[model samples]
Target: MSGAIIMLNAYFSPSDLAHVKICPSAKWSPKGEIVAGINGKGSEPDQFDTPYDIFIDEYNNMFVADSLNHRIQKWPPGSTKGATVGSMARPLVGIPYPTKIFVDSEESVYALDYGHDENNNSIVKWRRGLGNNGTLVINEGIAIGGLCGDMDGNLYISDYDKNEILKWSPGSTKGILMAGGKGRGKALIQFDGPRELYVDGTHNIYVNDEQNYRVQKWRPDHINAATVAGGIKCLNDFAVDMDGNVYTVDSCNSIVQKWSPHSSTPITVVNGDPSGIYAISFDTYGNMFLCEGNENRIRKYSIIYNDC
Candidate 1:
């Protein structure tokens, strides 16, 4: 109960993990299972190309930003063949190479354009059955890298170029700075290559300070941020559990690391592998889903707890 547990928005402590575990996972867990996509990469309905991020709703419905395919695919509770929900053909120019996604309670999906096109650096919103297109909301962000939303309907975006995170309220055109605008540095107030943000229940902001090789937590106090985890590299994605433990994606080495509160280094939750894991999410049932960018698929792992 010292550090945060793994996966998604669902929080778990070390004691509650006996119920569900990622089978055949890493050293802590068992192994992994491929829940979505296929053996090889393709553009078919059941395939993904450079799948970047994932958002799993309470109902276990998954929304994926199939980056290279130039579309957002929705996979229902038990379906492998996903339906194209967000695309490039339509009312909006469309999300070209969506890198990240966030799904609000209203089922409205926000897709962040990876800035593949200078004119298309935008975030598109798509609701259920919105026909193949989405409405462009925030456009031309300065190298938007990561995005997430809170219960208050506020959107948090990490601007890589500006080295800061901005908060956007519902229907608001302008964003207020939340953290790290003082240029990139090792200072707690500064952020270098900030990416993969998360908003907890209390509206706390968790940021992966990539260049600095650490994760910082910004509370509502409006004071200096705290370094939750340090001495890691290429934190492509991470999640904070109910216990405040931080789990991060050490992408450069192809592993997932679990960092407890106030820890200097992290324990490797996942072991060595060759695939490129860009993003990851965990479900309430202890299923771990990760976007294997190099493999072009989303794989799930069930943690096995033996006599724990």
Candidate 2:
């Protein structure tokens, strides 16, 4: 099972590629077409003048998490280029480094904002229509910052340093530790520095067990843990296809491995580029989007099926 999704720097021209820098993460809208990502220009630690994660909304509105700039930016539909959108631009809401972001079906935006030097990360929520009145859903309390909302509207977060997944109901204020502990694999059910999180239609939560080198699935109704995919060397992120096939970024191996439900063997689809894949998502059209952290760009791939 092999596939490829070639991606171009949508923000630049082929002739200017030599002079442009790229970002590290990418995601597709629920409807696909528009691809969003966090971009940082230049080399080294301080060149990130406009370090932001942006996505085009359902209405083609671009929402940007202007991280270091401490703001949520917008680019309304039809704006070919610029940082502002829909009349309101320039730091709509104030904050710190807004790194990871997720938008729920209700149009509410959830952001994982990096905290102050002594504070933990924060999970902030921007309620649609409420505008600037949006509140901080979760405080500066999590270890790392990845967010996902389930079908039922429940939020699942990855607490990196704690090596666990946290869950919160639709309107709840506190988060409950879903899996893992403070230490690496503290118990048989725990993991080692879990990163991104995904919840399926059946409400099964999948955690990218980063340092542990595997993916763990936990049912909303079950407390026991199950290794849906394993034996991966240096795993970082993954996505579950509509048919339940698991596609993962086997980083150290420089390939995206797909595993059928409960299968022990994996099918490698890309190879020879050991970049840290930080994110993955499948579009409604069945095409897949991947975030090659070190590749500094997003790639799209279509899965062609052959009758055996």
TM-score of 1: 0.86
**Per-prediction backbone clash count:** 16, 4
lDDT of 1 by residue, 1-308 (tens): 01111112322111112223333223444356677787567789999888898877766788888988999888987796888988888544588788888776556677887645543356777766658777777775367778887766677889877899988776566788999899979898999988888887777889989899889999996768999988787778887666677778877888887776755667777777436888877766656677888888777775555232
What's the residue-level lDDT of 308 in candidate 2?
24
Q: Against the unseen true structure, what C-alpha lDDT does each candidate score? A: 0.74, 0.55
Tens digit per residue, CA lDDT, model 2, 87-187: 11223233556666666544566677674532376566565665543355566456764677655566778887777787776555567777766467734
- C-alpha displacement of 74 in model 2, angstroms? 7.8
The reply for model 2, stretches above 4 Å from the true place, is 1-95, 115-119, 128-134, 181-183, 273-276, 304-308
**RMSD vs true structure, all candidates:** 6.9, 11.4
Compare the candidates by lDDT and give the number of the best one.
1
